[model samples]
Target: MKLKCVAIDDEPLALELVAKFISQTAFLELVSTFENAIEALSFLNQEEVHLVFLDIQMPDLSGMELARILDGKQGKFKPRIIFTTAYNHFAIEGYKVEALDYLLKPFSYEEFFKSATKAFQFFEEKENHLSANIASPSEYIFLKVEYQLIKILLKDIQVIEAYKDYVKVHLQGKTSPILSLTSLKNMEEMLPNDRFMRVHRSFIIGLDHIDAVVRNTVHIGDTVITVSENYKESFMDFLNKWIA
Candidate 1:
């Protein structure tokens, strides 16, 4: 995937050079160029930019200030920053904000390419890791309860119930359910659909652990869970496969 990029530098010549370098690069797509950091920030807020070539020192708003603001932002709009400046004094400050790379002023195309390659590889590795997680379903998952990450086997999970802001994981042979600080939706995603099904908005149950299904309710170890109207059809489909 191409890294959608934007160059922000107060110097007209510097901006033009960066824009030219971006145009020449195959993996980097130059979205727009801005001589003002404020305008760049506005554009970044509205668009999905993957990487940014930002100058550290500017008039109204500095690159460091902009980087900090972007860092504080939550969600997917957080773009990886690459500090481009003539001064070497800001190198320490640039890395403090977790910038991808620091490029000094009057950098040659070789230097620019090297920095851009770092961004490219960073994004490439990230995409591969996400793809791997989606393609390969794990047999177990980890849950954070308090300070520790507790490993829970998928087959051992009997029921997952939504409790306030947390989800209670009821495991087989366990007297008490493990309470985790996460939504039921997140729990659903972590579980394999073929083995676990959401019979209600508040509950996900393991199919193998179920004892019986009576009408709209599911029985597992004397605990009855009512199947919500929204999920009853899918639950019925699962039951029909075993009816013979």
Candidate 2:
């Protein structure tokens, strides 16, 4: 699949060069080019761009500021960002917002291709993972943590806790939970409905692992999860099946 991309830079020459490089790449499609970050932001809000080649030192709205805006945006339209700047100091700040890659100024086509390739591989792997899950409901799932994809068995999951932009996957035999950069709502969609249930806004518990239920609370080993009012009725329905 061709990644729909856009290049944003204050320098006209830099923008043209990046656009030319994008044209040379087989997997990337240049959707549009922006001379400023503000116009790019406006375009991004109405477009379905998958990748962005951004310059860090643009006037008025710097690429760093624009990256922050995109990073903070909710939903699934978050396009991967690759910062292109002459200064090396912004690398840390660029990564702080989780940019896919960073491109230093006056970079060769080879360098641009390398960064583009990383973005391609990421999206490709992500699509394949999702496709595998949907094609066959499996006993295990792959969670991407940082640069690696960790395999986790569905049966081993005791609880899933939402922690800001990440989810804590509490396993059966593990002391520390595996933290992944994902939302609990996304986790709910990935997990099997028959084996897992969302007990609270911040939690999803394994049905088979529940030790006991007391009033609005559910005990799963040492973890006591409170069943929120929204999900209390559903949790009760599941409990009623085993009620004598």
Candidate 3:
């Protein structure tokens, strides 16, 4: 299905670049472009735009405010959002709004294409799994380790444990000692409830990766993750399947 897309940025150059990028993509259609947030919100109320390319720093109304207006009960369709900004400072806030991808400004075609492709894939995958209960996806993330920005698949992470300033990421076959910028609280929000459980405040364990769950610990492969008493009640409640 061809996705209906729109770009909203104050800068003409940024809008032009985004429009060019969208025009080249086979599965996307450029619906409209807007410099003001209020106009975009008005259009959103009437049209079925599948994806929106948004800019963060704007006058009068910021992209954050615009997103809030478009979200929840305000609109019938929830378009997947792709945030583009020059400043990297708002990444945490952008993810909090459940933005599919974040594009840093002054982006090269390669960088723009990469984020765009991710947005496309996220839309398609989200469409495919609309009926299935799943984890909050990990398509967007920052890892200070390898310097390669990490966009982990949520289901791939078997266990996550907080280190002093970093987090040890254990996936299906690979385990990474990642220098994480996000606190465990922020990480907790990014993980979906259906596939993950907070055994410990510092430990977010993937349920499918769990080998066993004893009283004191949860086992994922060879790693033994401890369960704190505070989180135990909620964890056990998560384990109860809603069988009809």
Q: Where is model 1 more than 4 Å wrong at Cα?
A: 137-244
lDDT, candidate 1, 93-188, per-residue tens: 665566888999989999999999988977776676557668896667877564335668888999999998789999999999998777899889
Residue-level lDDT tens digits of model 3 in 1-244: 7889999998898889999999988888999999988888889888899889999899988898887666543434688788889999988776656677788878877887777777676666655554343454434444433212455677687877887545777778775545554457657777777777778878988888878767778887888978889997887776565221
Provide the global lDDT of candidate 1 against the true structure: 0.88
How well does candidate 2 match the true structure in TM-score terms? 0.73
| CA lDDT of each prediction against the hidden true structure | 0.88, 0.91, 0.76
lDDT of 2 by residue, 44-64 (tens): 999899999999988999999
Candidate 3 is scored at a TM of 0.56
Q: Report lDDT (Cα) of residue 190, candidate 3.
A: 70
Q: How many clashing pairs per prediction, in order?
A: 0, 0, 1
State which candidate has the highest lDDT: 2
Off by over 4 Å in 3: 73-76, 131-244
TM-score, every prediction:
0.57, 0.73, 0.56
What's the lDDT for residue 219 in model 2?
96
Q: Enumerate residue pairs that collide in model 2.
A: none
Better of 2 and 3 by lDDT: 2
Question: Over all chains combined, what TM-score does candidate 1 have?
Answer: 0.57
